[model samples]
Target: MTPGTPGNHGPGPGDSSTMTTVESPRARVLPWLSTLARLVLGGVWIAAGVAKITDLDASVRAVRAYALLPEAVVQIVGPGLPPAEILLGALLVLGVGVRVGAVISTVLMAAFVVGIASAWIRGLSIDCGCFGSGGALAPGAEPTYGRELARDGGLLVLALFLVRWPAGRWALDAVLTRKDPT
Candidate 1:
């Protein structure tokens, strides 16, 4: 077929515009949904970190319950994670330094997966302690490290996506970087 001519099979280049039709309503809505997800998840991480900072002792206890860390390590990691999380979350939410933040978040999620897996292997029931306090493992319940891994893995993927595709619609990054004809 000619360049502008309609193909007998696939879409022709001339007929194809930059904006192609999505097959599903969901496919069309996914971008907006992704933006919202980033915002919400980022906010949640920030809030959880702040809350844990306000109550380090509780956070430490929650971390210890995972039975994955040495007590000495817990003393350091438990206290440090909140501040790190706060920084990462803020960067992600603001769309500033998002690549770095996503990397950090991915690391944290990986750590969480390790902790959960170790606890499960050792037959220890414990909370993942993902979102600050109030999370606890129920007795006789096998640890769901696999689930936590999947959940956080998905979140990490989302973070990476957000880093690549910024929340440009309504974000501080866009505001600060707006081009002005000077």
Candidate 2:
């Protein structure tokens, strides 16, 4: 078998073009999925943060309504949460330190889940205040604990997935790691 022959189609003296890279289907799909998850989670965080940051007092009141924390603690936490969430969201959206951001996201989500569950168990009819100022519901309004939990659960899964596979296409991490970014 000679060069260019069916069986002799190996790389030539100066040509590596004949050398092919074979990838499974999963390889082509996982990164796209990861990118989607990153964007979704990041966007959610940013929106939630923006909403609460606009009204610090309302944010404080929301935390106060939970009745799960001391007044002193709530004072600090209420004011601090918006900025922290915004930072985390920016990290995720920019794909910088993705795993760390995801881990933080997971922790936050877990805390939210516990808070919502606790409110439901304690017969508290307060709003979760996830996206905006959460506090007592209107007289005729009902709490949507179940729906909030489900949404948070889904976001938690997305964060977990990002933690497992932090690298994705168009991500800064990919450039920093110097992998086959495409």
Candidate 3:
């Protein structure tokens, strides 16, 4: 038995276990940073989803402009993406299964990066339609591939951060974990 031992009452016999909850500065700060990441990523997803959902036909046209997929896949993905983005955004914002949400976000960002790069490389003058209608740019209007890629790249980083640190303040995960002893 020892002073640090668990279940000890002043003095105890056969007590060999101990518990500690001390956290380093980094540990304390990480959760808050993760919270920021979750909010930003979630907000982006929700905005993107809402924008596309409103004009599904335009969304489909945007996808078709990429010329990356067959018409069949484009038909399904164009319509389905908005809802999926909204759901993912909701989960992240709510702090429910954040790791899962972040992972999904990461994958989507990567796909978008690739798609954008492909379009740029192929010399297509298309609006990324990331936040809304994705189609061809106006006549003689330059595509802002560089800025678009940078934005998605930043979002991808946020997703990776959330995946690494899912726990955060003001999240359902924290509240639920607090209730569970384990």
Candidate 4:
């Protein structure tokens, strides 16, 4: 068929309709990248949550070390953070509500970045307690705010990407949304 003809497909290898709607390589690749991002972010969340869930006291102490919130808020936030992380992470990993998970991850990372920056500015020596067992650092132990910030920042970027493009190969979101595999 002639290119651009009413019943003809837009173009063929030798045709010149110039109106084809072919997907770019990047579009094809993004889903895989998103899948990787989802798994990594999810795994990190699960690990961090599991680490702290076993030691609520230590989590509380870590929150207290920030010295930013009221005691009452601290009590709730410290114990609550781990489970929230776990839930968000599980959602991301399972590709269920991936966008929602990414949004939550972004917020948590932002909070972490703020907390680490605040601690560094105040010259407080304390472990982030991100993976668990965080509190005041021992004598001569230095706070690793730079490293923590860098890690969280990277995670934030990943989360942002997922937020932008939550469609991944194995995500439940894709299936649930009934996206056609064009």
Candidate 5:
């Protein structure tokens, strides 16, 4: 209450005592977040691909149940996609060609979101093929499209962040940078 003294604008709950209000450029946080996001999303994709690869038929059926694709397209896309997911996930997590992988992930997730929403809107009971056969129970039953949409929406946000910032920190790109003797 002392007019001569500075106001007490102390840290709030969940804040550490050591935390200081330092001004940082927006440019700095984005790449770090992008790297973290890439790894996190990549892990999910890896798990999904691995699970599906274990049960190809189940995955194929799940994709088919979506009723979003032609049978011929499903036959071709279903089997091959799992491996591609695995590869992309691995590349992303490993920080190899991470920007490219993030771009691919963003595109794929966007496509899935569209497909799942279309099925749900049309009142088709189908599997989302999200986490392979573990996405939703009962093939002929209407899956929890809202939940799946939310999850994919979250992932899409991360993907967009990656697309903007890229996995630049602690990555091969950083390692390859020329040393600057400032």
Candidate 6:
């Protein structure tokens, strides 16, 4: 059989021209994993945002406690964060613009992680204000930077996964983009 002949045993491995690419099991499984990651991350953002939206002043105070930004910046960021979180979360939950949502989520989580770590390093005892109610901690109250960081880290991983594999079942992006799941 000739090397390039159809049905011929190729001289150097199978002929690439006639070969069909098969999806790996991992590849097949990724969409579901992405869906789970998207929903979980979205829910978290929604919960956090809802917790803070009720009291903008508390959110402001939480940002103020960090002392990482100028007062003007703090004023804007503190009130602005909750709505942003809610919007991002809703987008993820609805599977709309999932990659963009995940990217935004990753950025937000990274910022929180940095803020918490900085506060810990500076020995500033404060609530993370992640789910609202943030400010200086009471005297004798210990900071839970480790737990907060770990939680945010986990969420960041989820966000990264969603960013990489945004094509999930029931995703509006998939429908709008006309992506065939199979």
Can you give the TM-score per candidate against the true fold? 0.65, 0.83, 0.84, 0.84, 0.77, 0.83
**lDDT computed for candidate 4:** 0.81
Over 1-182, each residue of candidate 1 has an lDDT whose tens digit, in order, gives 12222222232222211233534554345435545756766786888798888888878888888766799998898888889888777777665654556666767766776776777688766667776653465666656777876777777677666555443323444444444455
Candidate 3 Cα misplacement greater than 4 A, ranges: 1-21, 138-140, 178-182
- Which 10-residue span in candidate 5 carries the lowest summed lDDT? 8-17
Which residue pairs overlap in candidate 5's backbone?
none
Q: For every candidate structure, what is the RMSD over all alpha carbons to the true structure, in angstroms?
A: 9.6, 9.2, 8.4, 8.6, 10.5, 10.1
Cα displacement (angstroms), candidate 4, residue 128, comes to 0.8
Error of 4 at 42 (Å): 0.7
**Stretches of candidate 6 above 4 Å error?**
1-21, 136-140, 179-182
Query: Which RMSD does model 4 reach against the true structure?
Result: 8.6
Worst 10 residues of 6 by lDDT: 9-18
TM-score: the better of candidates 5 and 6: 6
Query: Per-residue lDDT for 26 in model 6?
Result: 60
User: Candidate 3 lDDT, tens digit per residue, 44-116?
Assistant: 9999999889889888999999999999999999889999999999999888889889899999999999999
The local lDDT score (0 to 100) that residue 168 gets in candidate 5 is 43
Pairs that collide, model 1: none
Collision count for each candidate, in order: 0, 1, 1, 0, 0, 0
Candidate 5 segments whose C-alpha is farther than 4 A from its true place: 1-25, 134-142, 176-182
lDDT of 2 by residue, 1-182 (tens): 12222332222222211222445566556666887999999999999999999888888989888889999999998888988999889888888888889999999999989989999999998999887745757678899999989999999999999888765555666445544335
Residue-level error in angstroms, candidate 1, position 182: 6.1
